[model samples]
Every structure is written in structure tokens, then in C-alpha cells.
Target: MEANDLRSYISSHKNIFVLRNKQFRDSKLVIDGCNLYHTLYFTSGLDQAQGGEYGDFETVVRNFFKNLKECRIKPYVVLDGGDGGEDGDDGEFRNLKKKGEITIRKAHALSTGRLRNVLPILVKTVFVQILRKLEVPFVQCVAKAQWETAALANEWNCPVLSNKADFYIYDMKGGLLPLWSFQWNILSLLNQSGEKFVRAKEYFVERLRPRRRRLLPVFATIASNDDIHLDKGSLPNWAKPSKGSTATKDIDALFKWLSKFKKQKQAINGVLSHITDPAYSDKVHNVLTQGLEDYQLYLSSIAEFFTSGTALPDSSPCLPEWTLQQLAKGKLDTVVMDVLAKQRTVLSFPVENSLYSSSNRTSQPIRQTIYALLLGVTDGAYVEEYDREELEITSSRVEAVLPSKVVPNLQLETLKDVKYGALGSVLSYWPLGTQHATSCHLVGLGYKRIPNNLKLSYSMVAKAKQQFFRPRQRLALKHVSHYSFSTMFRPCQKCFASDFWVLYC
Candidate 1:
């Protein structure tokens, strides 16, 4: 329903246009906040946080704002509220519903120990909070965030910042900002002389005729969306065409047929009255309406797919080849490497050693330790032994050794979970002039000292503290409060006290 494949068609036909950073200077930009959030989360590996203070969320938010400010762009971020009713009033709401359905299916899979990956939703609230604290202008749309963003973009005559390929369908005139400038590959297409080559964006915007006709491709994209085919079995007969006939093909045929009629409605009706039976005309109208409605429903479903916080199952034990290639190429940042290391550590053990080892397994004490360490339950299945039989074996002969607490409130289930994000947060709260020389030396980084003598400007340090330290403290406090509400542990007082000191200090 997302019309994801439409991007390929756009690329092949050279429809997307790119503007340089200079072009965006002082420009008003409307953003699809959900789209941007997920993009940042995946790229930065923030969505893996199950609970506690997640610095990656703050980092991603700060980086996003920094990018916008660097470009001198005024941003209006729109967030999806929820799924609105079936009248197709809100695009994001419908999308959320579809995603929710997918999440339910994925959740079932998760319960059965199936390897499924789910999108994270808890971070969006944090993102919105950060935006508010930064005083960035944003709106929580009553319906679909996309429609609100598009409407705002249209009204302000500004570009929309989103990665969704379907934004073209909104018929926005302000154009779209490429999600990230670096993500787009430079596509080469022929020039006017047919002898030279030009960038895809230039070729599409400058050379394409009848600019309004750009929507034609978008319409075609909708008709040929993957969701339609995915849901074809459930689709009404009117929604499906005969063999070898597609909605896109039929729509093209209709356009060709209509070209023979006069442009005006009265003329077309007069021609139809003479050439076709009234019943046939009515039937044709019905079919078109039904097809359009079905398409709308499919679009709604796409919205749900994204909104559903269903983590997809990873069937393979190893990292994605592209990820490995990136690491080999040294394209990954230190932070990314740290995240990858954490994942690698988790996957190093056999499936029987994992927390989600068996279907009939009672919650293990290690689960609580993992929850405390990672600040969230491990919500995924082990890749190597994903089958029901493999997962049904409850016995675990191996014992997990918990790591010592680095700080007052910090408790690590294993040293592997002590990645940069978790360790960095604890390090930030330690007393000034603390050093971990031996550990740093072992890692080939020489002696590591906290609160170094290098003096940073007051404003710089304040901004850094505000962006990094404060949000983490707040999130930790919130998590502590949740723990108290659930009464999950008898040592709540001790835990809260330690959390308070560590977070506040």
C-alpha cells in the first residue's frame, strides 16, 4: 500500500528533483516526523532500547535539529496522532492501522518464538518531547501526519522533508527534500541533445513536459502498489481486473479511450449516449468508484504497516552483507561500531542461552537482570534456533555471569551490553577526574579520563549538557517511576534512591 516500488519507476522515468543545500537556505520546511524518526532510529540503532535512558534518541534528535539549523531551514514537524475512521480522512492514521495489523501478526510470531523484527514506537514520544524543549515548531496532527505536512507545505510553498516515495501523490507543488542528501545516488540520464548526460533531478524537472502531468505517474504508482497485489485475494471482484489486465493498464486504456471524446463533460456524455448503452456507462462508473475506494483502503493499510511497532524477524545469524561491507570499508562511525558490537555479543551465544529460549519457559531471573542491564526486555528470537522444537527446550545448563555495577544504580547483565550508549551515560555521571586507564589501554585507546582538563566554552558545555545529559536523566527518572508503579521489585526504595542520585548528580 505504500507504493514503495513507485520510487523505482520515478527513478527510471527520472521524476525526482534534487535541490542543493544553498537552495534550502532560509527555506520553510514541513517534515513528516514519523518518517524522519524511523529513518534516524534505524540509522543510529536507537530503536533497540527497551527501557531506561537512551542517549541515541537524544543524539539523533540533536543531529537532526543541527542539520536543519546548519541549513538555516525553518522546520514544521508533523506527528501522526492515530488512525482516524475509514472515511480516508487521515493518511497517517490509516497507515498506522495497517501497521498495527502487521504488528499483531508479528507479535504473534514473537510469542511463538519466531524471529521477527518490530519497529519501535516508544521513542517517538521522546522525540516530540525533545522537539518541544528545543522550541522547534511542530504539530501533532489530528489525523494523518502526511496530509498535515503536505497541507502545511502547500500553504507555505515550502519543501517537505520525508523519505516516503508516496509524497508525490499528495500533489504538493513545493517539491520534496531528498530524505538525506547523502542517501541519493547520482543517477545519470541523457541530455536534450541526446549526446550528453545530466543528473536525474535536472533531467526530470527541466526536460519533462507538462509539469502538472507529473501526477500521472503517481496515479499509475497507486494502481500498481504492492499492497493491492498482497491483498488481492481479499479484494472484491470489482477491485480485480481480468487476467493480464491491471488497474494501471486499464487506467491507461481509459485515458486513451477518453481522448477520443471532447474535453467537456456535456460533449463526452453526448458521445457516450449515442455510442454506448446507459447501463454500460453506469457499470463503468461503478467499477471506477469501487476500484478507487479499494485503492484508498490499501493506502490506509500502508499507514498501519509503518505505525505498527512490529519488529521484523531476522532469519540469518550473521549481520547484513551491506553492513559488513560498510564496516570493512570503514564507512561506519565509532558509535555504529559500538552498536554492532553489542548486537554481535548478543548473538554470540547459542539459542538455548537466550532469554527467549522456550515457549513454556517461565520468566528467568536473567530476564530481570537483562531488563536492568539493557533497560528493556530482549524482545526478539535467536536466529540459529528459531523453530518451535528448538525453542521448546527449557533446560539451560550454562550459567550467565552478571557484570559488576559501574555506577551506583547501574547493573549490567553481561559485559557485552556495556556498549557506548549505556556505558557513556554512566560515565557522564561519575565524579570528575575519573580514569579508566587500564581498560582504555587494553582497547588500544591509551588512558581514558573523564572530565578532562580541556576547558570548553560555557555556552558549548551548556548546550551539550542540555542535549545529552538532561534528556537521559529525565528518561531514567520516568523509567524508575514506572518500576515503582508496577511494584515489580521489593527493593524499590534502594533502586529509586540510587537512580535519583545517579541521574540527578
Candidate 2:
């Protein structure tokens, strides 16, 4: 659950948090890669209402890394892509399991015209490309990155750069630079080395009063909507004490009450005893205990990657070892990692026409191509893709399309060794064209020029040749900024619809 309300209340509090303004420079920064990209994309002012302007996003990412180099900040980015598992192993990715539910919720929101910040599917892919292009150090975790990132930052004795309020729970000697207050765009006044700096607010748990420190995990569990939280019906109206809706007063009242307790168990019990009904007490106790346990750090497998450059989590057996290395090194797209390993993927809601059917339907053919690249190469396989149905997320298995003719001898392990000619041949091969798929829909973007009113079947474009993928890519990058993917199409009166017309008509 999100602890937005609580983090907001804390941010407003002066004594407990105390984000001191500082000039940050000359350090190895551990960045939350997922947080950085989300902040970058949202704040960049690039087109969000359209599918996405990834070329512009590419430039934005380039500039960011370029600026960091000028400032001498060696950035080590860790992205959240893996599942943080249960049994509380090394703060792994079991925490990320809820993402499926969240994806459905977001898809639901997008379907209902309630969401405006729909991210395009390839943003993370583009981020990886730029990082590799710039030779930036990064790791795509097989599990949740929190423990790995925290461990790296602590070992380096440098601050972690992020906007995740959960950093307040971790005790850091160097501190936490809240991404919200990080003025990275502006450089500092000329220093002795002529080095640049980011003026930002730094957070240290030590700044809090002695007794209140180290209790943030407990506080977050109580405040957030994340896993291990009690049912909302059982939520103690900490606000009840004030008999008012003001969260500030309630937070103060809650803190004052919590100050007397010494141990975490006592705090958990005291709150349970006071607010929750006795019937729900046992359930509440278990939930809070489990939630608090999330913050308990173990030996992070991710940290080993930084040291020996070897530690990476296990994926499905079908995935070649080479693919896992590429994924961990940020060389391959995570989409490939997802389909082969999990046999499932959650597609993003692109900014397209709302009146027509879901825009996700239009791009279904493209994703099936990726599935083919991963699964259909050697043997036929199925992958479940999550796309929108009305306002709800619905799942259906898509069969991978094989390039049997183009790369008859090609296999997953030998993908990196695929020659240029074979690559082009494979790229031109349409992997999955359904019986009803119109060439215009796959080769072009469901229309040649602009879709005045178009919505495509999510599975229509299941597999596309590179030639087939490019025009649609252009639509997302070049045309969607001006045209909606939801626009409808019509056949030409005189001309037969062919690949050329799909590209030009």
C-alpha cells in the first residue's frame, strides 16, 4: 500500500524529518533506477497524452547522464524489475508481487478515462539503451532493488538519490537525497576544482529524536496501503482521538501516543489493543508483524553483483544463461526477460483515442513478435498478456509465432550470434498474423496517414517483421504526438490496400 498520506504528514513536520538544504558533489551515488525514470518521464514535459515520444525521452536521458558526468557524480543505478520474495530473504522482490494487482488497477483507471499519466511500454527499454550508450553503471535486479540499493549506498557511505519516502525507514550515515528537492538542472557556483553540484534536501533518520528513530518501519506499516496492512475496516482511526479529519493533528496525537513505547512489539500490541476490535486482533497482529518484517535487511544477493559482477537471480529454465546475463547487465530488453521466464506480461496503457476500443489492441501484434523471439524460436509456446477489457485488465494467452523459414536453425542461445542477413530476414517475417488481420493494421499503424477513429484488436498485431514494426514505431514516436491510435480507417476507393498503401496511403 502507498503511504502517501503519512509521508506527506512527515514532510510537513519540522522536527522529525528536517530535510536540510545542501550542495551534493564528489560521490558515488546509488540511485533508485525505477524512481529516477518515473520522475524523469513525468517531469520531463514530453508528450504523455500521446502514446509516447520516446526519441525525445531518449534525448532527455542522454542529457541527464551527460550532466552527471560533467558534475563528476559516478552514478550506479539499480532498477526494480524482479520479485522481492517472501520468507524475508535479503529484502528481495516478494514486495513487487502486488504489481500485478496495481497494473490491473491502473488499467482499470485508464479504461475509465480516469488516468492521464499512462506510461508507454518501452520507456524502461529506452532508459536501458541510453545507460548502455553512455557506459553508465547499472544493474537490473532479479528481485526488488531496495536491499541491494541500500547496501551499496551504505558500503559507499554516500547518499541514495530517490523520491521513495521509504528511504526514511533506512538509517543512513551519508543521508537520503529526496528526488523531489534535487535541483539537478542547476549547477552550483564555481568551486576550487571547477566541479558542479546538485543543490538538494538531504534526509537522515538520525535527525529524528532518539526514541522516535528506528521506529519508521513500524510507522510505515501502520500508515501505508502496502502488503501486510490490516483490512481497511480494521484501520484504527488514529484520527479518532482528535475527533477531526485533520491528519496533522491526528499524526501528532499518534506520535505522542507512540513515544512512550520502547520496543516495536510493544508499539504493535499497544495500537492493536487500543483501536482494533478484539475479533480482528489476531489477524491484525500477524499482518503488522509481517509488514514490519519487510524492512528487516538480510544479505542482499544484489550487493554481490556490485562486488564480483556475478550475482544475478535465477530465471526460468527455458531462458538461456546468456539472456540472464544480458538482462542483469541491462543489455537486453526486460520484456524478453518477462515473457520467457514468467510466460506472462503486463502491457502498458498508451495514450490513444479513448472513444474507440483500447489502443493496446493495436500493438498486440508487436508484443507477440517479442514472445516469438523468446518462445516460438525453438518450440511453440504460449504467453498470457494483460491488456484492458473495457476498464478492467483482462488476460489471454497469445501463441508465439515462429520464424521457421527465416531462421530455421536459429535458437535462443545463439541469438547474439545471428548474422546481419538473418536478422533482416527475421525482421521482415511477420510472426503472428491472425486470419482476420488486415496488412494495413500490421504493416502500417492500423492506418496509413492518421486514424480519424480507430481502435484495433489487442491481438491483431501479435507478430510483426522489423519492416512491420518500424511504421508503428514511427506512429508511436512521430505521429501519435499528432494522431491518436484510436482513429478509425477506411479502404481506398481506387487502390487495393497493399504494404505500400499501408506505409503511405
Candidate 3:
């Protein structure tokens, strides 16, 4: 679901979000890793264009956690695996909804000179890097992290720090602390509790919500989300033309209509009764039912994973157990999940590129090399890339090749297999963060690099025909603060803190 729309609308309603100015006490906080990075990137006052200001971003994140440590707030971070869809009749619709979101983001980047927000693709990888560096306990879910985030928050009797509107629907013990209201940076210098507490808006779902709390999820089910993709144009206007036509009025119309029903079943029926064409009622019903189920509180699979060390089985044909553990531990990126699940990968635009051109053309070979590594064990493997071909999003089968034309004699097995050391020998320009399984460029070969620091002139892909842009500065990741960029790689995956800034970062 596009939760921001609902979140924004509800936030405007009176008595919803309450100020937690001095009430912000030391406690366990369940942090949504994806939301944390997404919100922090935009609020950090860094460049949305110019490829990326990752160095500045690192500092922003570091200071954020440093403040948390000062306040003694223990955080457990959880992040989404991908925009993956569960396989079923409506799976295509859901996948399209997710991809449509990407397309819209791309369009936003294209329309604006990137003055608007388009999260740098490498944000998650770098986020994981920072998390481990701070010794923060965290988990990267196999797919969605919202359920587990709420679960952990409930279990720990603590608040959730996220901007997801779904959190508003979940009736957790400690409620939600929205990202916009989480003023972690602003501290009272003269006050005694200066660094001892956070200032933010908290949502006490059971307290602040309307009398009909049960209908919260019901309202969410009818509101425009990924499942329904409902648009105002299709529905009758709840506001007048003179009153100013906006999505707010349409939402008001929904709430007004819902006010008539005493129970959710009646409301659901009422929603379906208005379907002008009977043909779509069944589909709408199914979607609404599924969305309602999303709000149902239960023991989270991720929580179970944390306790039992098991992994979610959403991947097709399933991934190797060791790979799953690495993902659970945040050692490996979800790129492995996408590769295993969809057999396709998405390519993002560089900030300096034209809307028409794909800036990642220079690094396609690296991606292909990665594709080869992940899929090499299987026969006649191919990976379709959701990339750009002049003003349109296009898919292409990336051709795989080994770096330096040297093949690493490693068996396609677990990440712990020492044969991967041979795998490290074949690749140049990078060493692992500390150990010897993966390297920086190597993980980026997994395609994290192409969308990241691999900046070439947007219009010069053919004319210049350059391989890659050199690092803005030359040094190791630990000494990065001395220069323009900073990185703290994961040791278990053996990727991070490499000597060369170009390949490692």
C-alpha cells in the first residue's frame, strides 16, 4: 500500500498524533530500517541530485544513532526484503502496483531536476554497514518488515519509530513515533535531560483514535493502497469544485460513507455495493479482504526467525540455508532474494542522467558478472534487467562475464565455504571488510555498485565510453571521514572497509 497518502491525510485530522515532548523516555525502540534511511536521507539536507552525497548521509546517520546512544534508547532495526509480490491470482496486480511505484519515482526524478527525493539505491547497503558498525541488533526480513516491526515493539512494550501509516492501524502497546515528528537532532542545550530523551510525536492508537477503533483497518482497506490502486477520478467527489478539489475530500467521502455502518462486514458490503460494474466486485472483495488481513495482529514470522534462527520461505525454490541466515543477520543484501525470487533485477537512475538515458550503462558488465556469480551454478542462466532504453523503462538480458577474465574456482554453495577465497582472488580492486568471503566491488557486482558510485556522464555513454568514475577521494573506508566519503563494511560477508574507495564504497 502507498501508506503515505493515508498517513498524511490522518495526520491532518485533529487529536490523532500527540506531542511526546518531555515524555520521551529511555526504552527499547523498534526502528524501521527502510523508513529510517528514507526519511533521514531527505531530511539530512543533502543533494537529491549529483549522483549522491553518501559521505554526508553517513554522518547524518551516525549522528542519529549517536544521539540515541546518548539517550540510552535501545533500537532493533528491521527492513523490507524487496517490493516482491506473493504468488497468487492478484500477484501480477500487486507486482505491477510495486513496479508502478518505482515507475512513479523514476518519473518524479525525470520531471524534477531531482530536486525532489529519489533515494539513492545504495542507501540500504550503507545503512546495514552502519548498523553493524554501531553494534545495533537488527534484522532484514525476507519480504515486508512492518509486521515484525510491530510485533517486536509489542513484545518489548516499546514504541515503533517509523512513518508507515500501517503502524497507525496496528494496535501496539507503545504505539508509533512518526518519522516527521521524531526530532532526534534538536536537543535542549540548557535543559537537564538534554541528551537523555528524544522529542517526537507519538500515536497512542487505542487512546488517540476515534471511538470506532475497530474500523481503522476497515478504513485502511477502502483507502487507496497498492491492493486497490483506487483513484479519486473513478469515485464521486466528496467536496465541491469551489471548495477546492483534492484527495482529502475524497477521503472524507469514504469516512462519511463508512460512518453509517456499525460493523466492518456491513462497511465492506457497502463499499462493494457501489461498484458500478458487477464484474469487478469479486476482485475488489478479495483485495479488501487481503488488506484487512494485513492489519490483523499475530506472532510475526520475523520474530520467530529471531528466536529460532529460521528464515522466511517466500523465495521461489528457496535459497540456501546459509544465505538465509546471512540475510536474517543483515550480513547479505536482499539482492540475493530478488535474484532467487524473480530472476530479474531492477536498475535505478543516476542523479546526473537525463530522463531519457540510463546512466548505469557503464556498469552493466559488472552487473552481468554478478548475475553470473549468483546464477552461474545453474545452467543457461539469464537475468532480465528492468532498466532504461531512452525515455522508457525497458528490460534487457544482461550478459555475464568474470572480472579480469579470470574465473574463481569456488563451488556454488554456502557463503561460509572457504572456496570463496578463490572467488575473492579473481576479482580486483576490492577486499572484504575484514574476512574473506565477499568484497566491496564484488557485492556491488551484485548490482549495488552500478546504481551507486558508478557515475559516468549521462549523455556520454557512447561518446566518452568510459568504464567508471574514479573515487572522489583516494583512501580506505575507515579514513573516509578525512575525505568526502565514509563506509563501515560487514565482516561476516567479508565485504566492506576495502582499501580502494572506487570499488569498495
The candidate scoring highest on lDDT is 2
Error of 2 at 419 (Å): 8.1
Evaluate all candidate structures by whole-model CA lDDT and list the values in order.
0.38, 0.60, 0.60
Clashes of each: 20, 19, 2
TM-score of each: 0.43, 0.71, 0.76
- Arranged by lDDT, best first: 2, 3, 1
In model 2, the Cα lDDT at residue 459 comes to 34
lDDT of 3 by residue, 1-505 (tens): 3455566667776444454544465788889988899899888786544334667877998999888877778888888765452342345335544664565466456446545677655666677777877888788887677877897788778899988778888889888888887878964343664556777778776874463576777787667565564544454443332222356555666665566677778878867766776667887888778878877776666766656767755544546666667678766566666666666666654433343345455445555555656654423667767765655566777665555543454244532333233334333333222122221222233334532223222332212112332333112222222222233222353432111112221
The model with the greatest TM-score is 3
Q: Per-residue lDDT of 186-217 in model 1, one digit per residue for the tens?
A: 22223453322112111113223343243333
The clash tally of candidate 2 reads 19
